[model samples]
Target: MRNNWLIAACCIALPMATGAIAAYVTIQNVQFWYPVLRKPIFTPPNAVFAPVWTILYVLMGISLYLVLREPPSPKRRLALVLFGIQLFFNFWWSILFFRFHSIGIALLDIILLWLFIILMIRQFYRLSNKAANLQWPYLAWVSFASVLNFSIWYLN
Candidate 1:
């Protein structure tokens, strides 16, 4: 009983800390981010991004719980590590593109991040079908973001 709550507590912590780190990265570069050459039409409203990201973060937390619930194995451990790397790249891209305004490096970072995510999805799927299923939405979002990033890089 106690262990379940402990696991849940850890699950909650991961995304929250990631989000907090992402927020700090944003706060340090708001003005710069606002001026970036974002693509038209599909670009979401400022208000929309916050809510959407919030939902995704919650989903991420639950997905982590799913992965953690499974039996231990080297494969699961590797998947988790890959997931962490993708997340690190994910968190850093915002800072690079927005805070530093390095479009070229950001583009490269996003590409690598996308690859890592796809790999993570594959590994996660192996651990638990549901765990892999949960990452599909995240994969879709990143697919869209990659196009967006390419468009911005091209535009600039």
Candidate 2:
């Protein structure tokens, strides 16, 4: 049983670590493009993003674990798969926009990522309502990010 707890901690840690790495990737590159184009007048200060993501990634880890604790079934696996898809898209957006500096591709990636979150929410709702509920903020954030991505691509 102690081994199980150890595994659980590692499982939760994986996404959190990935998220921190992703955030660093963002912070280190944010300035790279700041001077290149006109940012939206409403663009929030860079400082806001870190606190927000820290909360979201913790929520994500909890949601993933909640979904995983149930017995094996198609529903459980589907929920996990959808969740994974959204996560991949999340990391990819950072790579596309920050690393490659392709605003158009980043916009495209965000749109798809938004759709993946919606699908994950629906799948998670079927398995555990709380897990589904936990993701709403993440979804909302992604939706907002999608709009921000579009604006960035369009204005620049």
Candidate 3:
């Protein structure tokens, strides 16, 4: 029981900390650079992004925790690998879009991130249905973000 909670905390901490680091890299860009961009008509207010992303990252952490608790197996291993890859791209997107201001490359990165999220969801489902379900919001958010990314790229 103790180990379970500990593992869960660790899993959650990993993603949340990673997200904070990514946010740190983009903090100045979001405050200064992003405001000047040619955004789409449907763009949410600047205040909307932080809370939404925090929730999504928490969901991702829980999903990963569920998967990690599964017994060691090939399926579990693959799921973890896919999760790591998706997480990497998730982190990278912030740097690419916000910090570097590479909207075109960020669009491409988000598409890849979207696909990888789907793949990760599928793999997680094979092991834990709850784990896979947790990723739906993350997937949906990213899908919307993809369009926003493309629109930003097109406008800019």
Q: What overall lDDT goes with each candidate model?
A: 0.78, 0.83, 0.94
In model 1, the clashing pairs are none
Candidate 1, which ten residues in sequence have the lowest lDDT sum? 28-37
Q: What is the overall TM-score of model 3 with all chains considered together?
A: 0.98
Clash number for model 2?
Answer: 0
For each candidate, give its TM-score against the true structure.
0.89, 0.91, 0.98
**Which stretches of model 3 miss by more than 4 angstroms?**
none
Output the TM-score of candidate 2.
0.91
Task: Give the alpha carbon lDDT tens digit for every residue of 21-60 in model 1.
Answer: 8778777566556555666567766676667667666666
Instruction: Please give the distance, in angstroms, between residue 116's alpha carbon in candidate 1 and its true position after superposition.
Output: 1.1
lDDT string, candidate 3, 62-90, tens digits: 99999988999999999999999999999
Ranking by lDDT, best first?
A: 3, 2, 1
Better of 1 and 3 by lDDT: 3
Q: Which prediction has the highest TM-score against the true structure?
A: 3
Best lDDT among the predictions, by candidate number: 3
Clashing pairs in 2: none
Residue 123, candidate 3: Cα error in Å is 0.5
